[model samples]
Target chain A: MPLSAAAPRRPQAGNRAYLFITPFLVCFVLLFLLPLAYAGYLSLFKDQLVGGTVFVGLDNYLRAVQDARLLDGVLRVALFFLIQVPIMLLVALAVALAVDSGLLRLANMFRLGVFIPYAVPSVVAALMWGYLYGPDFGPLTQLGERLGFAAPRLLGDSWMLASLGNIVTWEFAGYNMIILFSALRTVPVERYEAAAVDGAGPWRIAWHIKIPALRPALLLCLIFSVIGSFQLFAEPNLIQRLAPTVIDSSYTPNLYAYSLAFTSQQVNYAAAVSFLLGFVILVVSYAVLLLTTRRPRR
Target chain B: MTTTIERPRSRRRTAAGSHVARRPRSERRSNLLTLGMGALLVYFLFPLFWLVIAATKNTGDLFSTFGLWLGEDFSLFSNIQATFTHNHGEYARWMANTLVYAVVSAVGAASLATFAGYGFARYTFRGRGPLLGLILGTIMVPTTALAIPTYLLFSKVDLVNTPWAIILPSLVSPFGLFLMWVYARDAVSDSVLEAARIDGAGELTIFFKVTLRSLVPGFVTVLLFTLVATWNNYFLPLIMLNDPSYYPITVGLSSWSAQAVGGNGSNAELLASVVTGSLLSIIPLIAAFLLLQRYWQSGLSAGAVKE
Candidate 1:
């Protein structure tokens, strides 16, 4: 019985098996583990003129707690997460649901069209959108002028962040759709057949059947978006040059870390900021995961 | 009971105009759905279409002409020439740099992820559970969160500004590992490995002779993931690199755009080049996405749903 139980598993090579994992373990130690430890270690010190880098022991965290620049960036991304994630996920969900319904012709083409933007590097997307948002030569501005109205200043201080949101939404709407659509595909055909025999309309079938089955996928996407939304960096940073007055160095937390580290040469302080951002993300995403995940009935 | 259940469904199917009867059937024409889908298609595609058109215009015609329409002049080849030749051939260098970084990192990451994934899937080792958990936990730590500390660490060895700054970090793919772990578990059967072992194949040869063949799909998946991540990377390079020569296409193009604005209309000519360069940078990725789309889509869904 003992041999039979262990039989289903492949031969256990004992210590020799570690060789298979050595390469990734080395990288995992270097890139993932050591950097985190170094970040934590660096966050506890402050570089001073005469004294050199000295241990301040949570003073950096205290300073980060009080820093308005960091707070403003945090709140900005928080607002972004709240507003943009839903809009983006809704559009993605809509597309996924629509395509899964088999109602849309050339569905593969449309799915590909929606997904192609995701292939465009975010830097490229931001640049394209930045050009399109240009007051001088962008199409929308020209259309506005041709229609005898003042053109919208999309990259202006008022609309720049939301404009950044649009770029993000455009980039990933297809990605989330594909994920959700795949989950939708896993739904049993018998369930749909049963619903149809009950004379349920398409809307009813979708609402009660497809969506409930899609709950886990929805939760996964929500968590991914929540995490992604907080880490907004590349689009805003790239768009800043096009709208300098609107996007300061402290526009996003990651951008703030870059500015602090490279421009201000405050590597120690930037390490603190990075950890703080990570901590908040950890707590927030954990809370979302806990609240959203449901226990299966026995 | 069957008749009782069947009568209502038949009645409803007949009454509901055949759309609900069979979702895939094209018997019914729904204008509202067709229109909604068309709008979505435009929303996704209009920017690329604009980019193609924008690439064809010179600085003067780009601004003066209706932005959506073709201009009086076709300067696409000239713009292409300008893009390649701009700033003493820096754009071409950036392209080369990005390609090297992306390809090398992709190969390393895929190989590492597959090896680790296969190990985790097929082995029974000490601390396997905790080690796998630890690897998965790293996914929550965003790359931006790690950038500063990674920089601090990399600078200790003075790797900043060289390709290693980007490529070293890009090689470790937590999500890729996770994907391959699931793939290896499902795809590589235990019986096959046991058979290889009984045939006197060494562990290393078993991996090369048996395991790698089955892991190719997963390896390709991880390769594409890492390739795209490296190719599109911006912040890591923006922080790590100071030299224009080391800049990838993303950072390089951004600096050009910045220069265009900072010069404030004297170098308005640079804007056209920036547009054209952006077009050039994305073409390869778009082509990759279109060609390898089946693998990409299947790979993405497998990773997502398995998670």
Candidate 2:
């Protein structure tokens, strides 16, 4: 990547150069490529009582277009994307800016503390939050009761989605903060001095200079968060055992495909669901990447 | 500077108040920024604090105790014993399984990524552009979407329930390859390879003796990440492994917690065990984080270089 793009490299790799890459390519095909191809192939066939794995052509997709459960799951995850990602990114951007301004004392402490959650496994973090979200004995619930309010129902039907958002934001906001902060570090100090001499205060400086410099990092975080929205399996799936009434088996598309293949034994339909979800994510990521890259970054 | 604010300052101003008056507006804003960052610190660390202390209490006190305060009864020792002894010592087995999976996969992956990364960086080969693009494009695909299909693929080969199911896929990190490629382009110069070639060293010998020496940091970075990832993985193992013995700590802990509260509420005291079990599972990872934090920062920044 450090090599200049306009310059041509002298030929050093012989035909045997592939020998170095063969191992990775082999595993890559078996694990990534083959499974994707197989999922596509599986989606084209439907298991019928009489015909047994008949060619459905576009039939599975046609059903998917009308599948309420899949649509509902998609909508819920989409809602999560709209709400959670922005809030998380904003918080991240704020903290990153605060630290980069050379204003926060013990900045490393804040940075590491915020980032510690990213180190915790999503499962363990979910379980920890799940324990705290318990209505009966959960710390949050009891704390609420003691503070002159009724016990809060975090896992209740209306609040469950928000609760999921809080957990995800807590987990990743720090990570995004670090990414943004790294980009902020690369900004020249002269930019700041120039802004300061213009009588721009800290907030105005952040608004005008630092945030603009963080555009690539912010775009990167946005794309990753979007992909993460579609990949919202672990948090919901792990917490389902806590609130079975609110979180159903097919709570998210990933969970739906999981239950279909493993529990309902509908592998063909499940495969189709997986492919459809993958397609949606691909299109969205491509569009975001396109929109960001199409314009010249200042 | 002091005299400049003296005239405008109020007559009631004390010595420290005059010092504060001497400060620029932005300097005072930094004090507020410090407090704001402190608040963010607590927000991030509070749950981890809760997790640590909650593991110390017996089951009955877990509900009765205040959120932040420690319970009157400290039973962390017994809880640890119970955690290790739970379900006929399945937690220990799960921990062992996790260690095996994380280590094997990290070593395999780092090695493969290093080799592939070196090849991609140093060699100009046919179809490299399209091939690298295809691999880079895979980075956008959700890993969850690939799991079900991957399960289907493994089932055909009769490796679904085995440890290979977990280890095989962990070996194929597109990001790791990309990171190593970037690291190698700068770390390993073309002149060194040419000098080695003129010295009549084989490509493999040159890579092993010359290139690999300079690539330790990249390898270690990849190793640490893959280790953490495989250790924390839940979904793949949940679907892939049905046997209790093969369960990693992630799946095993969830199963334990599920039974502890489990709609039926069969094991009330099991909550203590679950809490303790959760604490033990993350201790190694947390330790890893604290020890190698610099690597984590560098690893991520290395990834900031995009195509």
Judging by TM-score against the true structure, name the best candidate: 1
What lDDT does model 1 reach?
0.83
Error of 1 at A250 (Å): 1.1
Give the deviation of candidate 2 from the true structure as CA RMSD.
Answer: 6.8
- The residue-by-residue lDDT of candidate 2 on B1-307, one tens digit each, is 1121222222312322333345466567778889878887888888889988998999988878886779989989999998898779999999999999999999999999989988887888788777877887887888888898999888978999999999998899887898787767667778878899899998899999998977776788788889988998888999999998999988998888788777764787888887788888888877887898655555555455333
Best by lDDT: 1
Q: Report residue A130 deviation for candidate 1 (angstroms).
A: 1.2
Candidate 1 CAPRI classification by DockQ: medium
Give a tens-digit lDDT track for model 1, residues A1-298. 0111222344458576688889999998999889989889989999999989999999999999899999999999999999999999899888887777655677778778887888798988988888789887788998898899988789898898789999999998987898898667656566776777787766677799988888878887887787788889989887777777899999998889888998899989999999999998988888888887757769
Residues B150-263 of candidate 1 have per-residue lDDT tens digits of 989999889998999999999999888988887777667788888998999998899998878767766777888789889998889988999999999999988888877674
lDDT of 2 by residue, A28-132 (tens): 998999998988898899998897889989788889879999999999999999999999999899888877665567777888788778877788889889988
- Please report, as a residue range, the 10-residue window in candidate 2 chain B with the lowest summed lDDT: B1-10
Off by over 4 Å in 2: A1-7, A188-205, A296-298, B1-24, B305-307
